[model samples]
Target: MLEMKLTITAPDLSAAINNLAQTMSARVPGLQNGTSTCAEATNTTSVGADAVPAANPIQVTGVPTSAVPVAPAPTSVPVEQTAPVPTAAPAYTLEMIATAGTALIDAGKMKLLTDLIARYGISSITELDPSQYGAFATELRTLGAQI
Candidate 1:
């Protein structure tokens, strides 16, 4: 014999029971007239049936209790999915190069900065796109290293 507590939340309680009964009828071996009453059987897992209260006890028979699938309460499922990791921004950006250049210019390399802008054939730093920023920053660093 097996016993388990069931806290069912069906909108139509009788319909749920009927549906359960039909499903159980197919699975269990000794159901009389292809049906069972709430009292005729009890959940098979009841090691200590007397100690347990039966506010809404599910009656199961003719199957191992461990074979039964117990549905956990809705609250047990995690409502909030784990947030996806935020994507990191690209390391090279036009604004970052511009800012880095500004610091270099303040250190007395305004002419060198202007020379770099002319080498790229761009009238101003604004003419360079984000894609060009990495190469330009690399060239600028190489130029600084030479000096």
Candidate 2:
């Protein structure tokens, strides 16, 4: 029986080990470069029996486990559009008619009276009708007195 023990000192033991592994791989049959078969065998024993040996072990530094990033949920908001309101037309009132009548009488336009009579069928103040004028006779009488 023969027994031998060899010891080597290097500035970078990892680099020396890697170089030795590369050299041993090139020299030996069925050995990958820059990796220890013993280390791979130890890892295989540590894992489940169902696990298979990796074809490329030199590229692996360690087991990789990372947390997957999750994106925030998208926010949604509803938008509303408003339209402008339309203005109403000015109303024709009895007070407005009286004011206009006073102005007409002050202007001394009796032709306005004849035109009104022809249009509304009211000849005089006392005989003034209201049906055609739509409740404007009282305001017209007040305007006639002013004249």
The number of the candidate with the highest TM-score is 1
Q: Each candidate: RMSD to true structure?
A: 14.1, 21.6
How would you encode candidate 2's per-residue C-alpha lDDT over 44-144 as one tens digit per residue? 21234444554323332221123223788998786776785758533445455555566676779667655765655555433444343434554455546
lDDT of each: 0.65, 0.48
User: How much lDDT does candidate 1 score?
Assistant: 0.65
Q: Each model's TM-score, in the order given?
A: 0.35, 0.24
Model 1 Cα RMSD, 1 decimal? 14.1
Provide backbone clash counts, one per model: 10, 0
| lDDT of candidate 1 over 51-131, digit per residue (tens) | 445445655434345546799767765688799886963367676777778877877888888889999899888998767
Candidate 1: minimum summed lDDT over ten consecutive residues — where?
37-46
- For model 1 the TM-score comes to 0.35
> Which residue runs does candidate 1 get wrong by more than 4 Å?
1-90, 145-147
Residue 139 in model 1: shift from native, Å? 1.5
Q: Judge candidate 1 at residue 67 and give its lDDT.
A: 43
